[model samples]
Target: MTQTANRFHRWFAEPGPRPPLGTWLMSAAPSTAEAMGHCGFDFLVVDMEHVPIGVPETASILRAIAGTPAEPLIRLAWNDQVLVKRVMDAGGKTLMFPFIQTAEEARAAVSYTRYPPQGVRGVAAVHRGSQFGRAPDYLKTANDQVCVILQLETPEAVERLDEIAATPGVDALFLGPGDLSASMGRIGEIAHPEVQGLIAHAARAAARAGKPIGIVGPNPEMVGGFLGMGYTFAAVASDMAMMTGRAVEWLAALQGRVQAAEPAAAY
Candidate 1:
C-alpha cells in the first residue's frame, strides 16, 4: 500500500492551532460514516465495543471514511491481540482499546498493536495495512505509525490514570463518560456533578503525566465542557444520536403543525 501520514497520530503528537473534534459511528452504515466524514469532524470512532459492528463491517465503514479527510479510529470490543491484529490488518491506523482499568492492561493493549520485540502482533506483509503488499516499509514503520488509544471507563481506571497515561506506546487516553458514570452508581448520568468532577480529575491526571486525553459526550454542550477541561480531542455525539434526534424533532414539529391545523378547522 501507499504510505501517508497518520492524521490521528499527528494530532496526538503535536496538536495544531485548533482543537480536534470527532464523533462516534454506531450506525454501522457506510453512508452514515461517509456523511460524517464530510461534516468536518477531525476524526471518527468506529465503535465495535458496543455497536455490534464486527471487523468485516468496520472495514466497509473504514473504506467509506477513507474517501474523506476525516480519519478513522476503531474501538475494539477488548484489548485482545487477535482483535487488534484483525483491526490493524483491516487498515485501521488508530485503535482504541476499551475498559482498560489498570496500567498492566494498558501495557498489554499497547503490546497487542505492535510487532514482536515492541508488541505481540504477528507480521503480515500481505495485509490491507500494508496496502495489500504496496506500502514498501510497512513492516518496519507500521509500529511507529499505528496509534494506540486506551479507554478509561471505571473509577479504578481513573485512579490509575497517571500510570496508564505514562505507559510506553500509548498514544493517547480516551475517557468513556457513560460507563464511568455508571460505575459510580450514577448510571446514565454523565452530567451529574460528581461524575463531571471525576472526568475533570482524570483530565488533570493525564495532563500532569504529559499525555493527551480524549473523551465523548452525547451532545455539543457536554462535549464542550469536556473540551474546556483540557481534553485535546472530543467527540460530541454519535451517528445514532444525530439521526434519531433530528427524527424526533421532525415528528414534534409536524405534530405541532397538525395541532394548529385542527384548531383552525374547528370553525
Candidate 2:
C-alpha cells in the first residue's frame, strides 16, 4: 500500500504565508460534504457535537470526500476514546475536541488518537481509514500521522491556554465563539471587548507555543479579524447557516414577486 500524507497534518507542519480556509458541516449529510469539498475548501469539519450523526453516517460523509481535494475532519461530541477511535478509523484525519479546559484534557484528547506508547487508541485494520482492511500497518504509523485539535471555548480554557498549547501532540487550538462568550458571562456577545481580548490572547498563546490556532467565524468581518490575528486554520461558516441564509433570501424575493403580481391581477 502506498503511503499518503494527510493534508490536515501538512497544514500544521508548514502553515505557509496564508492560513488554509475551511467550512463546517453540522447537518451530517453526504451531499453537503461533497458540495463543500467540490467548492474548493481546504477542509470540511463534520460537526458531531450537535449533529445526530452516528459513526456509520460519518463514514458515509468521509466516503463522499474520498475523491475530492478537500481534507476530511470531524469535531467529536466529546473527548472519549471510543468516539475518537471510531471517527479516525472511519477516515477522519483531523479530530477536534470541544470544551477542553486544561492541559490534562488536551493531553488526553491527543493521546486518544495515538496507540500504546503514545496513546490508547485500539489498533484496528478493518476500517476504511486503513483502506478497508488493506493497509495492515496503519497502527504502526497512524499515531504520528493524525492531527489532534483541542478547543478553547471557556474562560477556564483561556486561563490555562498556555499549558494546553504546550501539551505535546496538540496540533492546533480552536476557538468556539458562542460557547466562549457564554462562559464569559456575555451571552451571544462574541464581539464584545472582553471576548475579543480573550480570543486575541489565546491566539497569541498558541502561536507563542508554536501551534496553530483555529476558529469558527462566518461573517466576513469576523473571519477577517480571526485571520488577521494569525489564526492558521479557520472555518468560514456552517452548512445549516448557508441553507438558512439562502432560503431566507430566496423566500423574501419570492414573496415580493407574489405581492407585485397580486396588484397587477386586479387590472
Candidate 3:
C-alpha cells in the first residue's frame, strides 16, 4: 500500500511529550502482532534479532501491524546488508540495528537502507514497499523515509557514544540493557549501581549530542526510569514477558500462597 505520511518519523521530529512507548514482539505470530498493535502502543517491534522470525514471517507481522495505529519496526539479527534490503523491501518502515559498537558500524547500518549515491540498498521498484509496483513514486521517497535506530549494548559503544550518535543519517540510538549488563560484567544485574552509572552516562552524552535515545526493559519501572533519565522513547516490556507474567499473577490470585511459575531462561 502507498504510505502517505511517515507518522513515526514525524513523531520524532515533532515537539512532543515523551517520544512514543513501544514493546518487543518475539512471538513471530501474526496474531500476536495484530493483537499488540491494537493495544494502543505507539510502536511495535517485530524482533528478528532474537526471535526465530525469517523474512517472510516478518512480512506477515508487518501486514498485521499495518492494520492498526502502531508503527512497525524490525530489529535485524545483525548489521548485514542483505537482511536490511529484504526487510525494507518487505515494507518495514524502521530498522533497529543491534550491537553497533562504533560510528562506522552506525553509518553502515543507515547506508544499507538507502539507494546508491546516498547509500547502498539495492533498488526493487516492485517490492512491497512500492505496493508491488502500484506506487510509482516509491523509489523517490523511500530513501528519505526509512528510519534507522542503532543498538548500543557494550561499554565500548558507550565510551564512544557521542561519535556513534553523531553518525550521518542515524535517527536515534537505543540501549540494549541485557547486552550492556553482560558487557559490564554484571551479567543480568542491570540494576547494579555500576551498570546504572554507565547507562546514565550514555543517556546524558546522547542528549548533549541532540539525538533521541531509547531503551527496552523487562519491566515498566526500569523503562519508566530511563525516560525520567532523559530517554526519548522506550519499549516498556515484551509480549512474552507480559503473557507469562499475567498468567502467573492471576494463577497466584486464584491459588492463595501459590508460587509463581519458574522463570524462562533469558534469551
Candidate 4:
C-alpha cells in the first residue's frame, strides 16, 4: 500500500470552493460514525476528549470513516505523548490537541506526532499507521502527513495565538467557546459580548499569523457568524445535539404546544 497525503492538510494547503464544514462525533459508535461519514460532511471529528472513546475504539472509528469521502480528525483527550503515539500508531493522521496554552505546549504537541530526530514518537514497525509494515515509506512520510490542530480554550491560550501558530508543525488553530465562556465567569453564555469579542479577536490573530482557524457552534446561525469572521473551517454542533434537538422539536409539535420552526440552513 502506498502512503497518501493527509487530506485534511491538503484541503487547507489548497483552498476549496468553500471552507470545509464538519460535525462532532461524540456517539462513540462506529456504526454511527460510518453513517455520519456518508452524510456529505467534509470531515468528522472523532472526539476522545469528552467522549468515552479509547485507543482501540478510535481505531475502529477511523476504519469506519475510511469508506466515506469525509476525512477523520481525532481529537485527543489531552496533550500527552503516550496518547499521541498510540493514536498515530492506530492510524490517526490528523490530530487536534486540546487546551494548548503556550507556544511551548504547541511545540510539544507537534513533537509528539513526529518520529525520532524530529520528534519523540515511539516507533512501531508493524502497526496500522504503517499499513502493518506493508507501506515501506510510512515512517519517512508520516511526519509530513500528520496535521496538528491545537485548541485554544481560554483567554490565556488565545493571547498566545501568534506564538502558537508560528510554532513549526502546527497546522491549524481552534477556538473553544464553551471553555472560554467558563473561564470568563459566564458559564453557558457563549453569546455574551465579551466572549464574542474574544472569539473575533482570536480569528483576527490567527489570520495575522497566516494559519487556518476553526471553531464549533451550537447551531448554524452561530457557525455562520464565525465563518463571516474569517474562520477557515467550522463544525455545527454534534451528532447527539442535533438528534436530541430535533427530537424535542418534534415532541413539542406533536403535542400542539408549538409549531415546528423552519429548518435552518446547514453549512
Best by TM-score: 1
> What local lDDT does model 2 show for residue 84?
91
Q: After superposition, which runs of candidate 2 have C-alpha atoms over 4 Å from their true positions? A: none
* Most accurate candidate by lDDT: 4
lDDT of 3 by residue, 25-59 (tens): 97789999899999999889888988998999999
Per-model TM values vs. the true structure? 0.97, 0.95, 0.94, 0.94
- Clashes counted in candidate 3 amount to 0
Q: Clashing pairs in model 2? A: none
Local accuracy by lDDT, each model: 0.90, 0.86, 0.87, 0.93
Q: Per-residue CA lDDT of candidate 2, range 1-267, in tens?
A: 754787877778776777888888987889878987998889899888989998999999988987788887788999899999888888887888999989988889988999898888888768788887777577787777788889889988888888998999988889898899998899989899999998888888888878888898977789999888878888988878988999999999999999989978999
Lowest lDDT 10-mer window, candidate 4? 258-267
Clashes of each: 3, 0, 0, 0
Higher-TM-score candidate of 1 and 3: 1
RMSD for each of the candidates: 1.1, 1.5, 5.8, 5.7
What TM value does model 4 have? 0.94
**Considering only N, C-alpha and C atoms within 3 Å, which residue pairs clash in candidate 3?**
none
